[model samples]
Target: MAETQKEILVRYLQSAREALLWKLDGLGEYDVRRPITPTGTNLLGLVKHVASVELGYFVSCFGRELPVPLPWLEDDAEINADMWATPDESREDIVGLYHLSWEASGRTFDELELESEGEVPWWRPGQRTVTLQQLLVHMIAETNRHAGHADIVRETIDGAAGLRAGVSNLPDEGFDWPSYVDRVESAARTFRASDG
Candidate 1:
């Protein structure tokens, strides 16, 4: 049977989710949680952020009860509290919450029609209302954006880069990355003196 629109959206969203999680594979506790960017983006933190946001979109925004309360999102919590894990929060804690969120979101996907309307309380007044379809696309884009961040952060951590495990979606086995980078750099350098 042909997949429905919801199924298609779910597929893309799941792919991005997997890619983001893949970045944390085979890494130590410190590596997964440490900030790789000036803005403090980290692999596991990406997982946490996405999980929390996904819950907000799929569960809370639709008037569905959250599987569990997210303490970090409370008003009194520190800024960006959802973006990193505390020492007390183990890797399993974050990953477990992510998985639980997936289950809750999957239920949302199963029960809601694409055109079902819901209001995003956090959005601007005029734009607060959204349909399941819109939120699905929004989340797919958002997840992929974070997955791209995870890719660069993972590459910087240990020179690992790919779409996912066993599927690089990059150049061939014998491709020379260093030479390619040098060539690309040389081309850009040619414009250095031309700029006024």
Candidate 2:
């Protein structure tokens, strides 16, 4: 049996969404909100950013309104405000908002055909127009890119790395943890020496 185009797109989109959310497991509020990178990328912030993107592309772009207020996403908010969780914003709040966002986006997906057209107000006027198919593909790519970022952020915090929990997402190497670290370090040193 052949899966429909919408089914395929939805599968990929859901995979990315779950992967992003899973990165928050087994962590405290500090870990979820800690600024792992210089740019202030955190687990909660990633979820918030994805939620905002979903609202803009899936709901707002289709002549609909976002169901909730996102101050960081508003026009007058500070730049990059979506990239970090605020002091007053708890982990639960951001996660709940993301879940609600998923519900709103899912409705949009169900109600619109692939050929349905919409506009992205934030984009350059000429290029703002998009179809449901285009937004689906664009968002899949965007979410997957951020999932990669989440993967690295998780690894940095606690050495957790994989596509998902149950799968053997990496090559089955016989090397122990210490040797793996040494092998990687040696490769970096070798490359540095070659560059000298």
Candidate 3:
């Protein structure tokens, strides 16, 4: 059976979301919150920012009202609140909120036609309208880019690698662990030497 364009788009969006969330699997709150880059991009913060942008584009832009008020948007003083998780926000709370945002965004996408258009209030007044298709593509690109960051961040944090939980298909138990590490370390040293 041929997959519809909508199905493909939804699948890609969901895949990206899963990859981003997978980055947090088997990690502690402190590790997830620790800033990985000079820009302070932590795992939880990336998840939070993705959730905020997804809600804005898929729900707010489509005129769907948010179920709960976002104090960050209401209070102009803390404009950057959407970009980072606050101290009061726990790992579970932030993850749950992100899942909720995903559900809301998915619902809006499901109900609206690809041709349907809406205005982004934050955009310049006269040029605010965009089609649902455009937003979906934009979001897929945005989410995938962040998912890549999550992959690198996760690897740096705990040596956890790969896009999804089982995407990297390795043997179940017969593999030798020390040999794997030696090979990886040798490759790293060779690359560094070549660069120097």
Residue lDDT tens for model 3, 1-196: 9987877898899999998998999998888998888877789988888887888888889888986666666656476676667889888877887899889987987798888997788879787899888888988999999988888888889877776877854455567868999999988997896788
Off by over 4 Å in 2: 171-174, 193-196
**Alpha-carbon lDDT of model 3:** 0.84
Q: Would you list the rank order by TM-score, best first? A: 1, 2, 3
How many steric overlaps are in each model, in order?
A: 0, 0, 0
Give per-residue CA lDDT, model 2, range 42-133, as digits (tens).
88899999988988899999989889988998889999999878989888888888898889989998999999999998899799999999
Model 1 Cα shift for residue 55 (angstroms): 0.3
Query: What C-alpha lDDT values do all the predictions have?
Result: 0.94, 0.90, 0.84
> What value of lDDT does candidate 1 attain over all alpha carbons?
0.94
- Candidates 1 and 2, the one with greater TM-score: 1
RMSD of 1: 1.1
- Please identify model 1 stretches exceeding 4 Å from their true place: 194-196
Whose TM-score is higher: candidate 2's or candidate 3's?
A: 2
On TM-score, the candidate that comes out on top is: 1
**Number of backbone clashes in candidate 2:** 0
